[model samples]
Target chain A: MPRQIRRWGPPLLLISPSLIIIGVFVYGLIAININTSMTDIHTAAQATGRKPSEFVGLVNYTDLLASPAFQHSLRNLVLYTVVFLVGTMVMGFVWAWLLDRPARGEGIFRSVYLFPMAVSFIASGVVWRWLLNSNQGENASGLNRLFQILGVPFLQNNWWNNVNYGIAAIAIPAIWQLSGYVMALFLAGFRGIPEELREAGRIDGASEWKLYRYVLFPQLSPVALSAVVIIGHMSLKAFDLIMSISKPANYQTKVPAVDMYVFKSAFNYADAAAVGVILLVIVAILIVPYLVHTARAEKS
Target chain B: MRRMAAVAAVAAVTLGLAACSSGGDDEATSTSTGTEAGSGGDVEVFTWWAAGSEKLGLDALVGVFETQHPEYTFVNGAVAGGAGSAAKDLLQSRLQANDPPDTFQAHAGKELTDYIDAGQLEDVSALYDDYDLTDVFPPTLLDLLTVDGMIYSIPSNIHRSNMVWANPAVLTEAGLDPAATYDSIEAWFPALDAVQATGKTALSVATTWTQVNLLETILMSDLGPESYNGLWDGTTDWSSTEVTAALTDFEKLMSYTNTDRDGLDWPEATQLVIDGGAAFNVMGDWAVAAFEEQDKVAGTDYIYFPVPGSADLFGFLADSFTLPVGAPNPDGAKAWLDTVGSLEGQTAFNQAKGSIPARTDADPADFSEYQQSAIKAYAQDTIVPSLAHGAAASITVLTAISDATSKFTTGASDLATYQSELAAAAGS
Candidate 1:
């Protein structure tokens, strides 16, 4: 009994602080939010009182389902997540691939690409909004001006206003800001690939593409999965970019986070909590499967 | 590694300790007032007007308070955002923890109704009687501050949110007179289009709150002053031809606007007009302060106009000041409120802030020419309550309007859809 106690005591002691903090801040808030979602809290006034809010279980979820904006937000969110994932992954891989070759100033280019991550998300949103200003018309300054000079039709298209392109335009900043981190992950994964595997692939007359596909791609799944999870969560909570890119006049570009902001503005704390819960559910759905798969692979 | 874990643990411990220490300091600092009851004393006022000319207006009021009562220290706990929304949130949290500041900023009307309902506000009726603030402030403005005959908040500035500031240079450059009537402003729109032809911003209106501001002025201008109230508080149907016509006209007017208005703050939008980068700005009287900061005179460098047909215009009066409620120093908060509504406070505040004094009896000689016009209009009872975005209830309702209006401007929704959405939102 003494030996068993000794074995477990130090381990529990080491993790106790993290456990307490998470239990209070994370798990506690989650419980409160769940309670709020079950009741009718119209404003901050109604939210805190002795008269407990009537619990109409699942009614909030039903109301959310009935909301047009919520439906639109959900659809846009799916499109945003998928596109953001594919775009960041492809761009990060390509950039990483280019830098993987023995090249001059590789380190400088790598740092330059990653420098955006160093800036806060809000700052990135501001700078990009300035760059994308289309009010300058034909003499177009910044990105628009450069696009016009290069005879690129994308600038004249007003992609930010185009509903089909609005989400994509907002996603561009996220891609720029996050692709660097992805590239770093992929670079590490590439380095981790056993060199002898590539040599053996070549010995078997495998082309460079075959060598990457057979030798490197499988090995990079763990890194790629991590990148996807990180960027995926970031895109899900993407607020400042959507806010900066689209004004109140352009409500079709509204996302769940922006909608949540609106809810808070209206003092609909309960509904905001409901929306938050919905967002958490969606994120869990997206990530849990990947996490399970990763866990299984690790166990093997 | 164990070393990495140890380093992270140390960092976490340091952060937790720092946070705990700072929070303790904040609590201690807030409740340190030990003045005897009824004796004039120091009050730490928490507000969010710590920048630009706003700071100047605040300093003027503080200066007056110090002159009147030398015992008060006037702890300027001014935070960083305009309107103290950030500070208000912090104040609410502190109040919940039973450690509120002596005074804190609150909106004039139903915005503070929550605090009053919670039994967290003080009745300043006696102060109102003693200071004779009743004679100075209009009954309507007074009515908003009073709830069940109890005044909770004080008026700092009676800001008019429906003024259109135009650049005379840009107007002249476009072959349009700066003093063009709202009807003539339409004539200038094409001329303003010509200003954009010179590769400058024609109109500086942005897409968010500014769009809503422009929408309110346009609605009032098109529907007339009474119709503006009717659209929100009145029994009129928003689906009527008048509302549709206004929306269509506004969509057309938006074409003359800055392309990057979506991302611009109100000050930056005002800057477009100040720099002659834009022809006109449909903004508020607080914008007058921005122009003053730039050393631009009202009638010469820039122009102010009531959107045509909105002569008896609708103006949103959103003033801010701290209310005494479980306050650290109720006496100090009362002193602050008394000075806020005093004639001297009104004059200095109005001059520096570019807003009219809420007081009816305050001398208009202290006001700018534009404020004088607004004051005369108010005397005739021509001004109505502003029901644009902020003046209305519920952030939910406001956001719905913001979203609907955005859709209306972007051509994503027609007038019918917009009205239906607004009605649904309001009903909700």
Candidate 2:
């Protein structure tokens, strides 16, 4: 081999297996899925030997967009994303703020707050499903029962079972399962801020609130952005959490991922592929700008 | 760790070689044994009966299979889901991958047609003759199982979909008779009003599928069984006044249902009736199993009757097993099917599942009173297929209808819009 080729061959060979893995599983499958989405292959006639194939470009997308179920799912996704993102970030920041102060049993309280993060979303969903059981009156149990026992019947709402705000209720378990992780992220960001920055702010007659507002909060913007991106994608691709929490045919908590699952379960390959593509677009819409900004920031 | 890595490298290569060699053996075995040979003496029966009475029925059936074929071991590949959604999802993926089980549970009629059309299932038609099932099994059910003049599957049990279960105590509490049957759905409004007056939920409906269940029953109540059956075969018109009236009746019925019905499943709704939180629950006979789980006495605690004006109709969904074409063991699969269709097997399974046996001559003494009534209904009543459970319509049509109904129940779509959507779904 020539010297230049020989020098690069070993390094290239070292990464080839990983590159091939990503090539087939990531890009290759994505290409196949996109092609399938462009076709009219569904579970019934197409699955049977009847209609072999028909390439109907963008028809599935058009039909899906016009679909009432898909539109409702989109609404649910938007509502869930807003509630989950805001709930997790606010609760995480507040917990981090509380824990940032020095105390004797600070480690215990921190671990207590972070304990929920250790549980999987599926497990959290199962436990929360019971607590938020919507049955009222004579059959009421779970949180409603507790509310009744506490003589605070006003606090007992139907929770996630309410059609108007049920999708937002799905965000509760998502926020509970993830807020601790976000708190950990914020805690690390808080600890990473230089001690002299806070001292300099104090010397300049800045209050404790002003010090955090000017010095700490500005530095945590990147942390907050990363949290948003992470939770945003999770909320976008929310399937197992939603499915595990409610009945599959529930209209209120119908996210795009669950809609994709309904199509997939019926073997509507083309429509399922369309839902997948839409989700990819949503996640891309959410994350691509953040990625570009970070890339540019890193270069600068 | 290095040794383990070397072992893994060797294992990966072996697995790769094994996969490459499997296709050749499949063809070879097809000529001899008529199926791709399964590894060892294993017969994996795939199903969605992974919990509760369904699992109980499955286990009892598998026990019979194991007893009949002592030399072969059985693999109960039961995925968990009440409506078989998870199991069907898994089955489709395995079918696409060409890695099918020895036998898999599938709904009879249009649901099994998907596999039959795909050439994924074997013709077990001859087995019906061998087992003397030609005379014993109901001809309508056999016809439903047949496609292109070949029977592709064997039915184990038949479940009725149009039954209204009532808590007898709740009925009395609402100042209604336990044995009273409304001549028509429109007449139930008075009883519902009475229940509502008593401060209990008048009706208990749950989820979108349950709404679809009610819709199907209302459609039957309005169109009658004959015209309703015609809906699936392109004979009945979707835009007819009968369908319009059915939708109107279904809408009126929905007003009596608990507002929190969206989050509950069929079982939970049944529990509402049982707990006296609701006066009436419209569901499949599977609710009997749930009531039995709570040790509720059928005659005293709860009672079930046919949906109004559909007393002579059995809205049926049969759970059957198909012999996948590339199943590892054709012989083992045949043995399993024999157990599935046999008198002893159906008795054992249905006795637990709360559904009646598929056989015309199944012993009524082997079943509970509720199941015995269902068996009598199956024997005498005209049998129509369930739309929501992949029997009357194609799975695609059923899914679309489900989506439309889901939207409709939430008041996101109007009756006329849903009717049009239903037409589109049927035509597609």
Candidate 3:
């Protein structure tokens, strides 16, 4: 027992502080949130008082699933996730490819591309709101004005005001903000590949496109996957950007996160918690496989 | 020996973290308890008047508060957001945590019903008697303030929501009378058509809430004051033919508004009237300040009237303060409420806020030309709560109504669907 303690005690002691903090703040709060989601606590009055709320077990979930607004938000999430993931990865890869070889002013170009990532979504959202202002004709402004100046008035369509796919328009800003970070990831992935792999591809009489397709792109899948996961979860949890660009009541860009905020503001805590749990499950559905794959890779 | 030393080091670090966290807990507890023990300490008055003329009004009120209650320090806990949405969210969390401010801003009428039902506010009916407010404030105003014979808040200022602001230039360019008053919404449609004929937006509107604001006025105009009030108290049926007519009228009015109605805010829409891009805007009395900001003269540069068909009715929403149930300093809060209801405080606050004093007895000479008219109107007009500004319904119901209105205005839902959604919201 003494020998075992000597081997394990130091590491366990070292990790205990983080374990306790995470256990209480993270896992414990999630448990509380799940408990609250099952209860019929809708008002601040019910939430604060000594009397416990009645457990209505999954009623809140059933109600949320039935709600048109919640369903609309889910649809928005799927659309946003797809657009944001694809846009970011493609843009990131293009920039990474452009800078793969050493060139003059390459660092400057990279910094210019990456600088948007440093700005908070709220700050950038305010600017993008003006840039994407949907007013046309005499009231035209922002990018619409630019289109008019360029004599391409046809391009001055409502950006995020298109009812059917406005959430997809919102993904434009999300893509602009994160593609730079993805570019960095892809660049690092490129740097990590051995030079001999490219030489071997070239020696095999492969064209440039074939060399990239066979040798480079396959090796970069891990980086692309990482970018997708990161951007995927972000799109799932998007709030402030959408809020700053539009409003909570704005149906065109409303998401589940915004709905959660609205529900909480109305003191409908159970509904808010249900929305929160749904979002958590959605994110888990996305992340769990990646985590499992990483774990297995590490084990092998 | 070294391994044992490493284990002790790790244990010490873990103990330090635990100690740090516990220390934070102790500090938080001590501070909270200290605030709870407050007698004549800080009087934190929470509000959303963190910028613009609203902040100026708050400052003016704080000045009155300091003069009357020098024993207490006024803590400005104003959170900035358009329409107090952000502030209300923060206030809810604080209320849930049992850490309410000494006093907080709330709308008078049905908005207070939720807080009253939750037992989150204390009845300040005695304060009204002590201050002789019953004699000072109009009976109509007092009726709106009271719930089940108890008043929970003191009205600071009243904003008239059923006002139409028109640019004389735009009206003249459209060959319509700017100062002309329409007896009903039907009488007003031709004027909107005339402006539209001149290739201008007949009506300027902004966002979902503004549309809801317009809808409320139309409802008031069509149903009359009693039925309008009944809409909140469960007396009037939302599915009735009268309501359907009102919703139809609302849709007709929406057709005359700007194409980008959902993209702009109240100020921007009002600016359309100010700049003569649109002939008229239906906005609250706060637009008076917006016009004044642009150096526009009332009655010449701009013309004002009660919204068509809402002539004898005041579509009203008042900003009021409350004595929260677990307030740290109840006496201090009472002092604040006293000042809020006091003539000097109301005058100072209203003059700066571009709103009329809620009190009936305020001197007319102290106000502007438009406010003088509003003050007279308030005494004579039947005051009905403004739905868009949190006076007609609970927040949840109001949110539901707004959501339904948003869908209808966006063309996503039809009038029948809109009315049913509204009925469902009110029923819920």
Error of 1 at A108 (Å): 2.4
Error of 2 at A197 (Å): 1.1
Segments of candidate 2 deviating more than 4 angstroms: A44-50, A135-158, A161-164, B1-40, B66-71
**Cα lDDT of model 1 by residue, B206-277, tens digit:** 656778778777777777756666665546667778877877767877887876666567888898889887
- Per-prediction TM-score: 0.88, 0.91, 0.94
lDDT of 3 by residue, A10-44 (tens): 98888877866765667656777898899998865
> Please, what are the lDDT tens digits per residue for candidate 1 over residues A65-89?
7977677777777777778889889
Positional deviation of B135 in candidate 2, in angstroms?
1.8
DockQ score of the complex predicted as candidate 3: 0.36
DockQ of each: 0.30, 0.39, 0.36
lDDT of 2 by residue, B1-428 (tens): 95685446545654554565667655655564543455338889999888888888998898888788777789879888657777888888888756788899988888876777677888888999998888998778776666779988889989999999998888898899988989888888899999988888888998888899899998988899778988888899998888988998988899888866776788878888888889899898888888888898988988889888889888888899888977878778888988998999999998878888889888898778888788888998988888877788877788788877877777767899989888888886
Q: What does the i-RMS of model 3 come to?
A: 4.5
CAPRI band for model 3: acceptable
A131 Cα displacement, candidate 2 (Å): 3.3
TM-score of chain B of each: 0.83, 0.90, 0.92
Which wins on lDDT, candidate 1 or candidate 3?
A: 3
lDDT on C-alpha atoms for all candidate structures:
0.73, 0.84, 0.88
Candidate 3 global CA lDDT score: 0.88
